[model samples]
Target: MLDDRQTRTEKLAGEIADAILEGTLEPGSRLDEHMLAGRYGTSRTPVREALRQLATTGLIELRPRRGAIVAKVTSEQLEMLFIAMGELEATCARLSAMSMTPIERRRLGAHYDQMGEMVAQDDVPAYTAANTALHAMFYAGAHNPVLSEMTAGLRRRLAPFRRAQFRAPGRLARSHAEHGAVVRAVLAGDAASAHAAMLHHVSLVEDAFEQLAGAPAGTAPEAARMKAG
Candidate 1:
């Protein structure tokens, strides 16, 4: 069993990761160990662990003397990750459609309903959370543990970019619709359609990334709202 300090270290890691993903910590921003320790009411140990994990995820760079700085996303890297993620997610959706059990299907349906409720309330955080859960469930339903694990790792690497992408106008609404289509295909066991829907859904994200490729990170209007959601 893990001790309290170890558990706190892991929790701090997750919190820092979320801050990175949500752009609360902007790209290239320095992560000060002392400041974070003071902010989170912990010692330097957990903050160091958190920073180390972020460094591994490419969300931060650990400089020998300067401590950690948030990683900057290049256009090429953004395009590459989105293309790969789309292919992987499409494959997962295809397999999930074929493998989904009745219980899993019902649970997936419930997730969609919950997502709809979030959208109805214009709760972007809730919608985004449900969106993540729904896709995670789809990944599990696919039954390929290896692919699921790899996809999850890639998802974490791409989170910061994704948060920026979501700030684009109409993106969230369109994401909800695309997810609905994917759920429909999965429920009907239409593997091909499910794959296509997922591909197209991720393609939307790719389009946004492409458009923003040349734009300065904080200069773009959508990028400016990275902290909004």
Candidate 2:
């Protein structure tokens, strides 16, 4: 039951995020839990959870009296978030290279290999899931609880955008290749290489999002323009 609820919440969150990013739901649009529940044929509980998920991404604001309001995530803000995410991930990768136990490294390698199979099968959802899991391993391998916590927080903030990145053409394969670089560096215990590779991979992730959104890297989204008007 718990897993089902979480699945529903994540699915609804993804759908709502799609609407927002596609300009179907412009900035300032009201997201009434009751209406959303009806619209999506779900209970208010899931609707609320979905909205809360979106709130973490800065794609919507949950206000005291206003309930939920779609918010304009400016290009500048997006860029800054990406920049921070890249740095955090890079640091984590570097630390993981230096600190991951041999057993942990073996598990990480096996996990990455499974992702390769997902890519071969063109299983976007599976690849996305595995990709997330692989990153979590890197964070855990860092052995710095504070750094790991901070990186996880930023990752949640960018979750929506990062998930959308997989929808881009050839992104799954490209992402896997990028991971290969980082994984190889980490496996070799080359901290500097791991840092550079992970940072480069994240930069490409931002690029992938821009390409899919039809927006230049770090520019205001159409929803922002709609709000401005």
lDDT of 1 at 95: 95
Clashing pairs in 1: none
TM-score of each: 0.78, 0.93
lDDT of 1 by residue, 74-178 (tens): 555556788899999999999999998999999999889888777777787667667778889888989999999988888777764565555566667777898
Stretches off by above 4 angstroms in model 1 are: 1-29, 38-46, 64-66, 209-229
> How many collisions between residues are there in candidate 2?
0
Give the per-residue lDDT digits (tens) of candidate 2, residues 1-229: 9998899899999889877876767788899889888888999999999999989889999999889999988778888899999999999999999999999999999999999999999999888889889999999999999999999999988887898888788999999999999999999999999999999999999888877777542343573343333
Best of the candidates, TM-score: 2
Q: How many steric overlaps are in each model, in order?
A: 0, 0
Residue 127, model 2, lDDT: 88
Write down the worst ten-residue block by lDDT for model 1.
220-229
Misplaced by over 4 Å in model 2 are 215-229
Colliding pairs, model 2: none
Candidate 2 TM-score to native: 0.93
